[model samples]
Target chain A: MQEKVHVSGGTALSEQDVHSGEIFMTEDSLDCAFAWDTGVAINRYLTELKNGRIIATECRHCNRIMLPPRLFCELCFKPSSGWVYINDTGVVNTFSICHVHWDASRIKEGEKPYLPAVIEIDGASAGMGIMQLLGEVEPEKIKFGMKVKAVWKPENERTGSITDIKYFKPI
Target chain B: MAILERITRNIDNRFWDPGSEAFPVKNRYTAGMAGQRFFKEIKENGKIFGSKCQSCKITYVPARIYCERCFERLEEWVDVGTEGTIYSFTVVYKTKSGKPKESPSIIVAVKIADGLLIHRLNGCSVEDIQIGMPVKAEFKPKAERRGGIEDIKYFKPL
Candidate 1:
């Protein structure tokens, strides 16, 4: 006979007894929430975006104009000197034709593949670029150093967001 | 000195409120080691297993590999009871997003002789469920079992 231990107020089954379908087991869900703060620099950068203007923070020491503006110069370890408005026109620094969406979902047949690119804005400083979507040009025609310009949403629809610039189109 | 003053004047003092912007995320989780074994036992064998601490002589449901009280490895496994008493419970009237639920869910901490197992309560009204009320685990049909807590649909009055 197999050994069995009885709990004070419950019946305990042996390994063999449980294997015979005398015991029971289950699964549950959990939810999480979060709030993120976009501090001074990016907040003003977005506000300027709503007004159809592009802004970058200039670091007086290093003399570099950084986009997606930072409150401080990362290299100089000092507060940014000031903001400078730059032209929307830029050059495509690099790009990719993505067959899958940001969430990794496959694009359907007959739908155009998304063209995401890093665009080096015309002013501010060399190598200062921000990632944005490429549009209004054939995927095969896009190339490094190709000039592109911002295609803004109607002014009334602008929400002071990166999406305010609908996409970057070949100039 | 003039440049420093100009920089100070350029800094915007107004802060943007949270609802003005949106960021969304999705995550996936996997069960590991002891949890996989416990769920398999429930799904494949229709059994409930608990880990027993040889040092402290205490057993835990939703089996753990180590004992919390003694900090000892719990290698001994035991089968605990299917029926248990409600140790505590709460009625969830709102969803995680703060929306009211059409029908509230009763979540309970059930006390088996071994330890407490938290799960949902069913087949009884929210007003009828009392602390210390005896309830029995109700497993989904064997074919419907997925080796998770949902394998046992919910606990009902014994």
Candidate 2:
């Protein structure tokens, strides 16, 4: 979100005002709270994650398989034919080293930076991938087209979230 | 393509949470320089202050760093008195939701100190409020103050 300058006009306060925690400073939060509908596709996908599996959709008309499956085939312009279990093993399509968090806060020194990438699952059609994180690999060792496999959490500990598969590691 | 005909019968409330699904994003706000002093004065000292623009010679409230009109750097802090005359007012009888308020509220734009502060007026009924009537700010108790606009509870007729 873009920031608007109030009448304080940027130069109004001193650094002490922030650090001092004196008379003026107040701590609070604005909640952008709302319920999200994960829909038929993601709901089933997340449910499968809890069971230590990956689900995909097959478009019978085009024979294209999609990971993180969707109910409708954008290409075929119709509902997908059926569900298909995808191999959690896949090849890293592309990757990047993230130095900052979503809030742009610096990733502190000594903490490993996150490795974010898209992995093209084995059973999904070519070029179809799920964006996820990489683990158990050094920064310099990761490469494009590297064979990787999802590391699932203990079955009982799994939640219906993408984090159910802790991270993808080089196979 | 109806993926699975068997799954269709039980799809009604399968994924939707009526209200439990809240994605909470946290945020913080910092009162800038001019605002810091303004809120601090009321919270710590229970006094209202404003900054003076030497170029325009106008003492503006909610102390500003730069003059809006002349763009002059305002450095002089003035003790803008809390007491001011009622410049104008409105008797609001409805809540934000368009429902009748439990009691009619008197909101006033008071010409106080060097500038004007718009706040709710208390200790009087709507008929007792009038233009040019003197009013003074009643600040919140020190410990409960958080250095925001709420520092001043409301202005009341003196």
Candidate 3:
């Protein structure tokens, strides 16, 4: 049976039997709020993923495709004309050894020791990358320029999420 | 278009009723590994330590995992002397709930021997914590450490 682990505070856990929801406040509480309307973009991105197609906004002017797709073409100085479907294969760019887990609920349930990485898709031009978890490689073995591929969740289980791509592993 | 109109009308209404009810909010926060270690040390040693950037030879008080200047990972730990000079300060008369309190709180930005730290100034009148004033980091009882900035308690004039 595949076991799920909860990670929080950059710490790892043995199992996923615990979770917590607690409210905390600090001097910068007001500064943490967001004024964003990411709903439309998030929904569209997920819908494409459900169809087993990796979609990114491609700029016709500059010919660069943006992931976590953008409303505007960053390089061309024009709006994204439409979407571009990409292959699952990519190259691992810069990455980090995340010794600590980030979410409190995951840590409360005892999850620790996972590596997150930024992988640049092959067709993406110049400095474009996606930040996601790196799987199937021990943290020590990860290095620059490693070849990896996206391992997607089952179609039945797919959600319109960055998390829909379960992880990337060495080819 | 009607939705846009409603949004504009709501803004106009809020301009007149400053305290008109808004969505209720719940507090939430996340601490990084470096932050966790910093607070853990405060709870144990009553002293503060900062991570020094080996590349730029700069130090970050309340230690950070990455150097803000160079964007390099900082791994060296260094102890900052308790005493430092106040860079700036403010006296806050309102509480977290935006209500007035009997005793005002004094907040200060302190430049330690290595880097800058922002915390409260306690054990003195609000007038005592001044710009360029020499002060030292002081801690409260072990039980008072709650994994927050309050861990330091405040800086006192030396």
The top-ranked prediction according to lDDT is 2
lDDT of 3 by residue, A88-116 (tens): 77888888865554433233334445778
Candidate 3 ranges with C-alpha deviation above 4 Å: A1-171, B1-27, B95-100
Q: Is candidate 2 or candidate 3 better by TM-score?
A: 2
lDDT of 3 by residue, B1-158 (tens): 11121223332221112133333345544555687677767777876778998778888887888898889888898888678898989899998779998889888889975678888887779755568989888877897676667777678888
- Quality of model 1 by C-alpha lDDT: 0.82
* A38-99: candidate 2 lDDT, tens digit per residue: 77788788899999999999998999998779888898788888899989999999999999
Query: What tens-digit string does per-residue lDDT give for candidate 2 at B42-156?
Result: 8889998889987787889878888899897898999988898999999999987689999999999988555778899999988778999999999989999888888899999
Query: Candidate 2, residue A4: CA error in Å?
Result: 25
Per-candidate count of clashing residue pairs (backbone under 3 Å): 9, 2, 11
Top-scoring candidate (TM-score): 1
Candidate 2 falls in which docking quality class? acceptable
Q: What is the C-alpha lDDT of each candidate?
A: 0.82, 0.84, 0.71
Cα RMSD (angstroms) for every candidate in the order listed? 9.4, 7.6, 16.2
